[model samples]
Target: MNPFDRRPTYFFGVYHWRERLRRIGASLSLFGAAVVVGRRGGRLRRLLAALVGVTALVRAGTTARRLLSPVPWALDRPKYDALASLLPLGDVDRALDVGCGSGRSLVGLAPHLPSSTHVVGLDVFDDRVILGNGPQLARRNGARAGIDVSPAAGDASRLPFSDDAFDVVTACRVAHDVPETRRDALFDELRRVCAEDGTVGLLELPITPEGVSDHEAYWRRCLGDAGLSVERVATVERPGFSDEPYVAIAATPTA
Candidate 1:
């Protein structure tokens, strides 16, 4: 793929630079160990060296495959698509995507929205967490995706928009990233900017530690805490592309 192919690049801190370096270091160490053991000149040592060398190769290959795969970002297309479908975009005049990294979520939603809709994206654009993340990248990606997006820099906990400013609000895989201390502020902001009767869609990894009941309860509590009523919670699965299951939570500001 072209380095600058106008596609949204949202590799957000999953494999941190430190983590990558550590993996590389381990692989190199294993290779060194194999070399050292192979020179012992014994049948058992030779067998051990072969196994160790193979293990090192497998580890290296696994890391390389993960780096090459379009995971943790590009693979979320199906989730975004499901979210766009669940939202009330038919009559929406404006939409706001909170934490819109590189505008990939917007690209998924743009196709479902009216051409006249004004789509705005807001994010802090911390390049440390997400490589090459910024308003410029979002604009370029939006342009390439054939959608006009207004990308802005701002904090999610304290959005730079007035109350009831947007007809639809969306936060894709963003709620979990907020600091625990600011979770209330972040959700409140999401609800505050949304117009009356407007929808706030959240595509999140399910809290499925215990079971399905607990999972649903977790979301209900989350939305309730934010003063939003849960409208629907549905699963969206994309076989072969994504291994993790995602849930689309649709909510509206409570009366």
Candidate 2:
């Protein structure tokens, strides 16, 4: 049976269901507004309205897709291993997962880290945040090892942590999903949460070529400019998309 079928978890489940439904309603309202705007507007206004309509459609579709799919859009399928491979330190004091969908990667790698380490998973999706069993599983397994998984909702671009709070901060398959305009800010937030000498593992889809060369070059340039030293990079063949490979970059924020 579903764990959320119980009392505490059920409360959060109700909240999530309501939130998801509200978002769907809001997205539909936005689409209707765009259509109405287009009917009464000039060419330029119609163009702008069309853009808004498209954006709303995409947003609504993305939401519905996640609701229907087993895995969320951000970390669907073999992407689970994508983040797990990024941890070089193998569990330190505390680790944070940004855009952590369903916390599958956290639970998978929890045992790899020391029992004393704390693993926190963050995601903005209401459903995933409510239902992610990865954190609970990790908590259960790590009880003997003294590890705990705390899941929370957070924005990728605006982290609520002080500078250098986490020993390790990981953003798995998240950069591309974010708007390019906000990617820099999101990146900065990742750096902010990371301990000064700590590490940030970014596992992203390679927009460049498939090999490690392109992967290394892209992250090297972007992360280097952001004051991160590229410690290591490896080419990984993600299971579902074997033809479309991925790269895992491990970097440290400079002083």
Candidate 3:
């Protein structure tokens, strides 16, 4: 069996269904307008219409591909598996997943740890961020992944947990969601809740090709400022998605 093949039983819902619908709608509108214009236009005008039509078709194709792909969301199996394998989870007694939307990343990491480890997920449960996102959905997904997840409601910048509480803390593609002004606070909070010798794993997706290096550097700096020493940073490719690179970092709180 292919290691990357998705397990038949493990499932995570498609992320942001509404956004996919909106893209499809916009593409159809553009295609329709181009068709109407091309039917009664001069040569130059017809050429412009053809360009628009091609653009619409391309946009629609991209959106359709994403809609059908279960990646960067439904575990993006390889990326999550890499994250799980890279993190030091051997002796972790308690773990926390910040911004655990639908518990996807949490579930991904759970199977890699000992069954005795206590895992908790924290999220704002805002549907605006992900359709059908909430504690109920998270618990259900966790069940599908064969892990019993405990859900909590809270903000990343101000975690509800006390300092040095968790042995392993993780956040996947979460830090980029916080406003730039408050991101420092979020990092600080992540570091605070982590035990002095505990490991913190962060997985992030870079928006642009040009920004990948800068993005990695920025996150490294953020961890440093938060008093965490960087231990490892690995670049993993999301083959199931667009072949984009995912940045995974492992750090430990400084003495």
Best by TM-score: 1
Give the runs in model 2 whose Cα sits over 4 Å from its true position. Answer: 1-86, 128-147, 207-216
Looking at candidate 1, the ten consecutive residues that score lowest on lDDT are 9-18
What is the model-wide C-alpha lDDT for candidate 2? 0.68
Could you tell me how far off, in angstroms, the CA of residue 90 lies in candidate 1 after the best superposition? 1.9
Q: Estimate every model's Cα lDDT from 0 to 1.
A: 0.78, 0.68, 0.83
lDDT of 2 at 153: 69
Candidate with more favorable, higher TM-score: 2 or 3: 3
In model 1, which runs have C-alpha deviations exceeding 4 angstroms? 1-18, 71-76, 208-213, 238-244
TM-scores, in order shown?
Answer: 0.81, 0.60, 0.79
Q: Write the per-residue lDDT of candidate 1 for residues 88-190, one digit (tens) a residue.
A: 9988899999988867787777778887888899989876655567888777666656668899899999999999999999998787788768878988999
Lowest lDDT sum, 10 consecutive residues, model 2, at 7-16
Ranking by lDDT: 3, 1, 2
- How many collisions per candidate? 0, 0, 0
Model 1: lDDT of residue 33: 91
